[model samples]
Target: MTSAAFDTSIEETVEALTGPWRQPRQMLHGQTYDSHASIHDDATAQKLGFKGGTIEGPTHFSQFAPLCERLWGKAWFETGCISAHYRAAAFEGEEVQAIVEKPADGGNYATIRMMKRDGTEVLRGSASIGIDAPASALDIRLTELKPLSDAVILRDIKLGMTTASQTVRMDFDQNMGELYPFSLEQKLKVITEPSPYYAPESAGSSPWGRAIIPMEMLSVLFQHGSKKDRLPVKGPSVGLFADQEIRLLRGPLFVGEDYRLDRQVVAMSGSKRTESLWVRTEVFDNSNAPVATMLLNLATLKESYASYDQEYAALPRS
Candidate 1:
């Protein structure tokens, strides 16, 4: 079904996962993640003659994290999980909506999408959750843990060394103490405005009653799409890790401006079963403006985290 039909029932709230996402304009370009930058000025995306800027894949995939959390509960952060491949980009100013539909077999399967308000599909994906799956297995029942560092970015090596300037909106000179346990005053400084997709109540009131980075936006920024080169792999094997540590210095990200996204490499090590790399990222809303930053450690294995890719290829419609 189209976004219109899907969105027609926001109140029902019976939707599977995603919902009527607002296609806000100003929230564009200013904020981004690894994948977002990776795709913007790449070779294949350039040569294939794709129109407009290449949309990052991780940006799209993480967009749904909020949906899962909203439905499953904030604590779901430690419980539920998702993993998917991005098929395409959702351009700036495009009308976007997200929806989830169950597949025929029904068991732990779904069809999800990010669509332009006009009904033109932007990003189409699949979804599955092991509901009955033990919360312990998902770590939903686990106690929250604080990072051993001020947010561990790739084992050390500050997040943004290679990140060059690109257009972004908003600006921030954050007081690290103000984040984490964001104060009433701090909340006012960040979420300067509100929009449908992610609305901060008001300057005096916090978005979801807390001052923090727009989780959805932040998730997309972490995308490693065209922005960076994929880890070199020898086999079809893949490695995956859940959970992350974020330290938001500032921002509920405003609109109508330019920003810079900085990425710095952290650590790389090899194991008998896998190889991995870690990196730190700092997002500045406008030129030289520091809003919020994150120390993300992304990992991949020399061999698939699952079994052999050959067996994966044979699985019915993942």
Candidate 2:
């Protein structure tokens, strides 16, 4: 028997769907660090005051998939965008649920939030369709982003500089080395939303005619495919994803397809405690066709790294 990809139950007044509570799977981070020792590593995280390696922020977006489909149907897959601000970290084995609120007038966007079973808010964001989505969580955050007043680690990254493109693909059975670096089967085992479509044999049942990559994994795809060594920012400074936005152009990106990734530094903004760089990455298929785009706000903690006052003082004044 073929199981449906998602729950199609639609409410009469405003559509609503509650996802199954899921625990954080550490597979993505494991792939991200190549099993290296880092903050994402369990022991490192414990030393930093976290219970364990925190799950990547994008993982929570999967809970909104079924909800977005119910509200906008297939269009959600074609042009849908989910912009979010991760408020708190969720440790491994902790269950969380996503709740989506649709406007009474049946608009193109909806308010969404993910919370732990105990009602602790994990993330808050919006899901919308089309190019003109209402100010999403990341959108609002971008507007509020201010230029750094002092010289910082990210001060050297210039806006509008495009990075070298790289080829990226996701295979259901193969462990994508460096790029994702994990097999699809591994991800499916602990994915927040388990669907038949995520499996190789049942992937044909999907609307995309094959296994469609989950929205969350797109972050991994972009990161590993982009040019990380060329960024001018000096590290050893702890950084975190402050906000993120993902949008597909043609439709759901399928698994096992090669896509070219090009990233551009769009903006640099910061706050009193942190400095950030906003990068927009565009994904193109083998045919040079545009597939999707992702915007990431990577924030560096100023307190974690040593102060640069001496370095700034030595530099010639602007």
Candidate 3:
């Protein structure tokens, strides 16, 4: 592409795409782990000071697809990436809008954000297309992380720890297990954008000629087997998605297709209120070809852990 043509594509005068207000559903109300209700449970959320069961952060990812597709066309589905830091949680029935700004610098990346009807920012980050679409929000944030300090819940978690490859699939009606109990068929009913590409019956009309999993469901699919991979984080405590990035290398991951997942602890950091475990999961097709990647910062609440302070005090000082 010529510099002039690229400049014309992302002129400063280009208007940002804003999506319609949509209410994302809370599918995790029944989510359980460590023999107890998860943070998504209403009671569990209230105890932690949240209004009610909060919608999953990734659920908002669906809202960005149409807007991004408008900006980058088909490339948005194949190599699209959304890197966001969740600023606040949104509950069911709360309307939210997604906005994607055209890059003023004529790059393949655009700044993106979501806002609740009450003007509260839900999440903010970047949306980019292609492998070379400049540095992502998480890519820049990862470099600015402060070292893990006074670790408790995530003290034992070391960077570079990789889990064994696990084979997984996301069939339309198959429930995604404990972490995500809902299936693709169930999600489509409430998904922010209804795509014929994602429906089995109309999939033949899609460019891929098969039903493709929605980008948001890719979050459920990647973490579907997380419980069985058991990393060393002391996690009877509740955790939330602090920040996340989903990038498709060879995507529009198909429905009912078998894939392999490999996860690694890429980094770890902590704040006064939460300890974070930054994990990166790589998805591969049956032929062992790379398909997609997800980077998640699971921030475990300090107050939710019973013996955080006691255990941290026991660790030997450096």
Candidate 4:
């Protein structure tokens, strides 16, 4: 199940598969949302107490591909799922490793984790093959969420609200826009796992016959045009990914392929310090065939919203 293109030696045992330590690059330093600098900007993040601009969470996904591919083979690209709940932010220059625990019964599902060299956890979740792979990490986390209440930032959003389907594509050198200002070519230069399967000239020689988008880029592809959807969540506040799940259906989504994305607000949740908006985005091909899906929990920090307490106090008590 291993390939030279994946370019990494996996440390495997009867219990787990461990990937090499990788220093994920930060490409979101200039990222903007709602016309303001995002948490990926050092100055903005420092205002809220982060030591520095955080590397976007999905950037870590690339490190797990080699391990997951070794465990499941090509099918991991076709029907694989990675569902993670962020435990802490990872910054540039920090070394992190990915581990996928082998299923006890050798089934199609397993738990996964990423940790810094200091043993600080970056994220923990599940990975599996098959659309029906037993409840993923986010699936379990969703059921446990306390219904959102006393919210200020996400008070206007409602469940099942969908956005207009929009078209998206990722060319090798095309910048993905404000939310992700870099191009696929720039990312490939530093991707944790380099695969010819993701390159134009060499892709035709691969099993898929065309370049397949790396799992991490799927996040960019789906989110590229999302801001235009304008789903009505109060903002001018900072939000970060708290949980995320990317699942492929009839995929190995190709690089340079055009896909339509439709997003929906599927759930709302709250914690002591943040209110979360859970969204589900579906990707479809030109012929309208289902390609992939993503579940993201965009958690807005309460303290970052200046009017949070004042607004919450104005709400009628139950």
Candidate 5:
């Protein structure tokens, strides 16, 4: 395009979001939490060192992307990248605050700071405004970066397969200008307009309530491996939540509740030439109660298919 077109798009971006927008409500309250447990679930708040299960760290950050889309438009997730520090822990049913400190946005570049309700810091994030084409990015169209050939699905996993020896604090569910109360109630009220798995009730919430953690965000809590590393049998990890077979082991994760996450590599199989990895993830609350679990599969696409360099360009100074 010409200089005029560039100027026009720039202007549009500045005036992109009219009225007011919110940081995701999901961040407001965390699920019940507990890191220490016997089998992932069926423990007590005493052993886990808390009253309930804590929210999955990865699940906490995923909320930002949607907020970015709301603030900057759909293009944000295209070239967007995010990373953060887990400041505090959220439990199954407690409400926290999620806030955004505006960025110094430039074409192809933007920065944002987010925090939680307990007066804690969360993430220092930036986006490269579509700088390098990512692996899933297509030259001619928007193609999902496929790192595997078929979706990997596993079953009957042992609990506690996924264990993290780390701790982080988080916040969310800012007062919503005092329009709402209890982030869970407020959040459950609203659903992604085009959600794939569930929907909102006329009350604008899901009776299902909140569980251990949303399965889609689980991929981040593990060692996803380097974008450059390729496994002959496993291949590199580039997959989406094709489907989930989630089970509620115990109760739901509520605010003030600590949580422990466990993962079981249920199974892995596909032609060596065909890349695929499947696993089952399980989560339990501090009481050692099975909060929720799921079976998710990721399909891999040949690495030779796309650009790896640009995809890592915006990955937050690793």
Candidate 6:
């Protein structure tokens, strides 16, 4: 609620963490007319009933990095996985805290929650190491997903459609193109959690032998690359991340490493107000070894598009 709630002494404690964190919410945009023009802007988001531009859900994942490190140590950066469901929107300068519950078995898995200082839950999820661990928040949701029975905003996208394979790399000093639109140096200046591991000098000496990409930056590396226009999910409609999961299969992906990416539409579903497309993206090393996988749930708000009502009424029922 107040800045006083974020006491550094309390944050150093074992069970709790207090963060007066802020994110530059409006800066990131999707590759669409609506996403670039309105969805991520304050004035437009206000019209959609949100406080302001919603902070990208992946940005909050950075907040949990310290907690994960505390629980599982550096191995987390290599093999850790976080699966989360965005419960509510977070605006810039909104102080938030990540609370961690130690696993009963003293294992690598932990229950985690992010809440505003005023006690409003922003997201809920599970964090763990290893790919074979029990079902996490996103894992369970993946199983329960129902097929899209009615034509919604995403009706044009077919399940199993895949994005063309693309090559991607992250460099501590290079400027990433449109997908990221910023350099690592610029990102560090405003990053919510800054650590030496993200620096070239210090990180180069670590076991990874190079500046390891931060978990938050991994989203940029995986998403910000050249892609073939294939899936035709109507235009001028705004979409936001509803849920996300990142799993490191054989890494702490390093900066400046060449990695190949492939993504596929795995499922489609919708609610009264939104339609969603679930995609699974895989990353591979130069040797063709598996590196990491990202599961993203992109939800498009129905009200954002003017043709929703007429379009839905014309579709044949499943």
The best candidate by lDDT is 4
Flag clash pairs in model 2: none
Q: 171-200 in candidate 3: lDDT tens per residue?
A: 999999878878899999878787878888
lDDT per residue for candidate 2 within 41-140, as digits (tens), equals 6776675566877777888888788878777877887888998887888887889888788755778878888899888899888889887767777777
Candidate 6 per-residue lDDT over residues 46-80, each given as its tens digit = 87788777777777887788777766776788898
Candidate 5 has an lDDT of: 0.33
Candidate 6 lands at a TM-score of: 0.89
TM-score of each: 0.37, 0.87, 0.94, 0.97, 0.33, 0.89
Task: Give the Cα-based TM-score of candidate 3 against the true structure.
Answer: 0.94
- Worst 10-residue lDDT window for candidate 4 reads 1-10
Name the candidate that leads on TM-score.
4
In candidate 6, stretches whose alpha carbon ends up further than 4 angstroms from where it belongs are 1-26, 29-35, 226-229
What TM-score number comes out for model 5? 0.33
lDDT of 3: 0.87
lDDT of 4 by residue, 243-287 (tens): 999999988898778899989999999988899999999999999
1-318 per-residue lDDT for model 1 (tens digits) = 101101132322344654556533222222323222212333423433445444433344444545543444333232233433333455545556666653344344445666766666665544444445322211321133222222111223332335443443322232212111122234333332222323233322423333333443444433322134233333332223222333334444543234566665554443343344445566665446566544443444333333434443554552
Candidate ordering by lDDT (highest first):
4, 3, 6, 2, 1, 5
Give all candidates' CA lDDT scores: 0.39, 0.75, 0.87, 0.90, 0.33, 0.76
Q: Supply candidate 5's per-residue lDDT for 194.
A: 23
What RMSD does each model have against the real structure? 14.2, 3.0, 4.7, 1.5, 18.1, 4.8
